[model samples]
Target: MLVHLLYASRAAHTMSGQDLVAILKQSREHNAGAGLTGLLCHSDGVFMQLLEGGRDAVNARYQRIASDPRHKDVILLSYAEIAEREFAGWTMGQVNLHRLNPGLVLKYSATSHLDPYSMSGRAMLSLFRELVSSGAIECS
Candidate 1:
């Protein structure tokens, strides 16, 4: 069975541009080899990620992420068996929320900021879909 997991974590410390780049690079390669696909959004020192794949693979990956030193306050937002992958084409898509339009954020999140902590997992997923559809965010 396939599973989808959404989680939010605070950065252990402020991440520089190079830090984010390195994370994405590693994630893409690792996810592709593991048959996983997902979207990662970063903003205001928080990381929100959606991972979809075989149940074991997704759970294992989430466990690793939860224990990573780079992440703090890891919170599972949602996890469940899903009939389809929402980001199947993306090995590890990335979005820098700071660059996104405020209007789009407000439209879906009722705020001009990317505050995933205040939003439900379903809401955050919808926001990401809208951002992708409107060309406001692109997967790497």
Candidate 2:
């Protein structure tokens, strides 16, 4: 069965552009090899990721991410056995949430800023879909 997992985590330290690039490169390569697809959004040291793949693959990957030393406060926001993937265009697409229109963010989150901890999984997912529709995602 296929599954989709949504998660949020805080960076253990400040992140730089180079660091983000490295993470994306590694994620894209590994995910492609593992048959996973997803989108990742990072801003202000926070990371929000959506992974869709075979159940075991998704779960195993999530476990690894939750335990990875580079991440802190890793929270599994949502998970489900899905009939199909919501995001399949990129091995791991990237979104810069800070560049999003404030009004767009305000619709699903408080204060025009995304605090995944304060938002419902459904809301966060909705925002992610909107980002895709708005051409806000960057692919490498």
Candidate 3:
């Protein structure tokens, strides 16, 4: 089965721009090596990621993310089985939320931000798509 996991983590205050870049690099390498696909969106000190891959592969990646020191308050948002990969065009694509205009957030999230565990994968991705299409979120 193709597992899709949505998770949020509170980024540590010490994370620098370089550290974010490094994390994205690592995500790309790992996702490509494991044949996983995903989209990661970050905003307001929150790291929300959607990972799609084989059960074992996805779980393995989640374990690695859980141990990363750059973040805390890790929480699983949702998990589901998918028949096809939604992010086939992405390796380990990243979208920085800070680039978004505030209006975009209001349009997609109903609020200025999202609460961890309050949204399902479907709802989260819908919001993600809006932001992506609006040029509010940019790939890294």
Best by TM-score: 2
lDDT per residue (tens digit) for residues 35-110 in model 2: 9999999878999999999999999999999999999999988888999988888999999665688898899987
lDDT for predicted candidate 3 compared with the true structure: 0.75
- What TM-score would candidate 1 get against the native? 0.92
Q: What TM-score does each of the candidates earn?
A: 0.92, 0.97, 0.81
Candidate number with the higher lDDT (2 or 3): 2
User: Candidate 3, residues 31-138: lDDT per residue as tens digits?
Assistant: 899988888776667788888899999999888889978778888877888899877767777775557665655655557666545555567777666655665534
lDDT of 1: 0.86
Which should have the higher TM-score, number 2 or number 3?
Answer: 2
Alpha-carbon deviation at 53 in model 2, angstroms: 0.4
TM-score winner, 1 or 3: 1
What would the per-residue lDDT of candidate 1 be over residues 43-124, giving only the tens digit for each residue?
A: 8789989899999999999999999999999999889899999789889888755568888778767677778788888888
Question: On a 0 to 100 scale, what is the lDDT of residue 53 in model 2?
Answer: 99
Screening candidate 3 with a backbone cut-off below 3 angstroms (N, C-alpha, C), the clashing residue pairs are none
| Model 3 worst lDDT run, 10 consecutive residues | 131-140
| Order by lDDT, highest first | 2, 1, 3
